[model samples]
Target: MQQTADRFPLSPRLFSFNYGRDSSAQTGCSVLDAAFKRYFSILFPEFTKDEFFDAWSEPKSFVVTVSVKSRGCDGYPDEDSDESYNLGVGDGQAVLRSVSVWGALRGLESLSQLVYQDDYGSYFINKTEIVDFPRFAYRGLLLDSSRHYLPLHAILKTLGAFHPFTHIYTQSDVKRVIEHARMRGIRVVPEFDSPGHTQSWGRGSVPSGTFGPLDPTVDSTYQFMERLLKEVKIVFPDSYLHLGGDEVSFSCWQSNPNVRKFMEKMGFGKDFTKLESFYMESIMNLTAALNRTSIVWQDVFDYHERPRSRYVVEVWKQGCYLCEMRRVTKAGLKVVLAAPFYLDLPIPTHSWARYYNVRPLAFLVLEIWKSEHYQTELSKMTKAGHRVLLSAPWYINHISYGQDWRNSYAVQPQNFSGTEEQKKLVIGGEVAMWGEYVDATNLTPRLWPRACAAAERLWSNEQLTLNADLAFPRLKEFRCELLRRGIQAEPLFVGHCKHEYDGL
Candidate 1:
């Protein structure tokens, strides 16, 4: 990206838009068209149709031309969709080009960020050129809606903050949120989280005498899972399904007479880890048969012997995260690191710096990786040649006073002692907002601006985004921008946006 000191003045009334032939066809999709108009209104909310037409009579009018290589927009974003875009702003015109409609949408967002209002109520953008692409293909946010129900509108509002694949663990109208998310270049991956978190699953629906952990001893259990997962595969079009195999208590299985009988007959004497392995293997095989890949909690990988490479393990436990990463990647499986990023933990106030300094591939000492304990187990996995996703440092639900976003902005996924080829294994990361303390009311403010930090970290060049000090001013501006978009983003400092108003 190249930026100039020159500020190109833009009149909200006179600014116009043009679409290249392919882009016009792509935006013809209702969702892309709505997104385009939404961005236009966001850029100039005060302008009316008449005002825009009347200002055309004025001399200098800025026009933005959008070009897309893809002929039409896809119904939803997939892992393979290209999100790279080239944006050029200057010469009375701005050109935004992308290989797909997803990239075009991202370019539109960058364009919106460039345009800002002056103290005199006029808008201007600096002359700049940006060839931007996401560093990782699967940038996401894990929203655990199971703990606290999130309304559809709240979910949609969260989607508006970034281009992400929302990992939703809710029973609430999944199809509705999926459709709405698709409109904004977002994919919704639903997680059922069984064998442990199944407490909620069997509430009133299970047979009166039988309940908890899906009853691995019963043939009906496998049948039930098959039917449930088949429905999940049909409802969610994404390639991966999260079958949460975390925190499974053996007492539930041990207490049941039928399970005890089955275990003894199978020579699995009191070994509940084996029992969990049995359950997870059956479910995973069921998932594969339905033609969907599985993402299980790290426990499954640890307990089971070499889960198939198709399964993605999410490491969320508190100890030895680097060990878990190395173990998983060594087995030729992908891993998503979530140990250091659990937002629901009751961390003390002003701990964002601790979260910021967390390097995914670093060793841990008392839950914090010391600078000296860096280049051992963590660096070894990078050379393993398997994809890894880092979920540390972007736990947006963990709030802190002052400029906590600076801490979040400081986290770099590849900020470890590894070669470039090894670093490439670090695919992407997610900002986890587990729904324990968060609800619809505070969701937007809690997530935004903070999540924006992770969003940039995942999208922009690592070096360009490394300096939190340099990012402060731009983030402050972005926080205000979210406010203007009615996002209710929390303020960065004890100050006011020049154009900020009440009820926005």
Candidate 2:
């Protein structure tokens, strides 16, 4: 059977739930499940509710065996396992396994393609036999509650909305997303972006007017984070909790002398990085005490900010220099490289070539060969080992460009500036929707086709060509499927249409 799918142009299109009482969680992610079932029912009359929850099917049905292993299996499980395949669907000769939420999302996309075959033209999961599994065992997403607060209702809404996917934001959303993600053998990694990002709820202000002040050293801040993180662990049972350690201007400390005084009393000298280390160490200790590891931004390592090895660095800087990537890996810690994966950049001129070219490590392909230097320091880190993460921002804040992020977001990965090897380095891609401008009307349309493109890159992701302009027909079919499923996608871009868009 043909494994590599016919590479279609990225037709990005990509969920939600509940009744009056909110039945979206355990019971089919009630809201989104209802929508999914209803939508699929319209398409396939035989798709019943029981079949959706059957959990286990046979090789004939194309079993998706998902296994959880401790160390790297070179992206495969035990040798005795069922047939093996990448995220792209092939024959039942092997199943695709991935622990990443992004991985599971990819799996879902593959299964979705199989289930919704007619929608995508002459496509079908012809014949296959296999089981799928994940290597590292923890695939996740981190939401910065510190920057902007997400209320309880929104948290539940996220559970419902992302029901079909492996992503859930808050600790509160874990138990819920887990019920589904875990059923598919995917892990739910929740993040608490504290310290600097927490101004939205605690310190109350940031900069002069952006939000307000955020005293990273505030005792109350620690108390709140401690309780929240602990509560989250309980909800998740067994999952990593992300402690966001990024983008703090340090003005919060400069403004508050008490924060400085607190640091000084702790025996840490008056160094900023040192203080940041202390702050992170404290949170790290708290999480460790609960037997949970933390996900922190890599900048914390900029000046010897030693956060225990339990804390993983999620690199987010713009450049993809080899020296920089090696530095974090050499520190004897796990790494998830997200720097070259910024999909939110509104500027298309940065070019995919630029993104694809950033290897941040040596011995890469010519496509990634650039004038940028690759140092031994990073090579050593590469030898020590690391985990690469790809993050695509679905961040549509209020100020985010209207309707434009669509053109750029979906194909960012394919449009990348590097070699094929570098592209494969991406374990998976995330549709990070930063809740800013998304209120109601445009959120659905703004995110659908674009996020689906991200999914396409991760799933059935062979021979990718981010020809957004060329994807209209396939996108229209995908959009029609989503519409059949109840998601409100943007109108098909039939230019010279019989109507006009609002003169915005």
Pairs with backbone N, CA or C atoms under 3 Å apart (clashes), candidate 1: none
Per-residue lDDT for 1-504 in model 2, tens only? Answer: 244443221111111111222211233333233333543344344344455322223213333333222222222222122222244334432244443323433444445645433343322344433234433222233333332344434433332232223333444344555655433434556665756655444333344543433455668768877887767776765545677776666665756677778778887666666777777778888888888766666555554434444455554544333443444444444445443333334444313233222222233422232212122122222233433343322222211233342332232322232333332333333345554434333445555554444343343323332454444555556766666555655554443221223332
- Candidate 2, residue 12: Cα displacement in angstroms equals 28
Top TM-score hit: 1
TM-score of each: 0.87, 0.58
The lowest-lDDT stretch of 10 consecutive residues in candidate 1 is 369-378
Model 2 regions more than 4 Å off: 1-112, 115-187, 203-224, 261-269, 321-326, 330-332, 340-345, 349-429, 459-480, 490-504
How much is 9 displaced in model 2, in angstroms?
27
Candidate 1 local accuracy as lDDT? 0.68
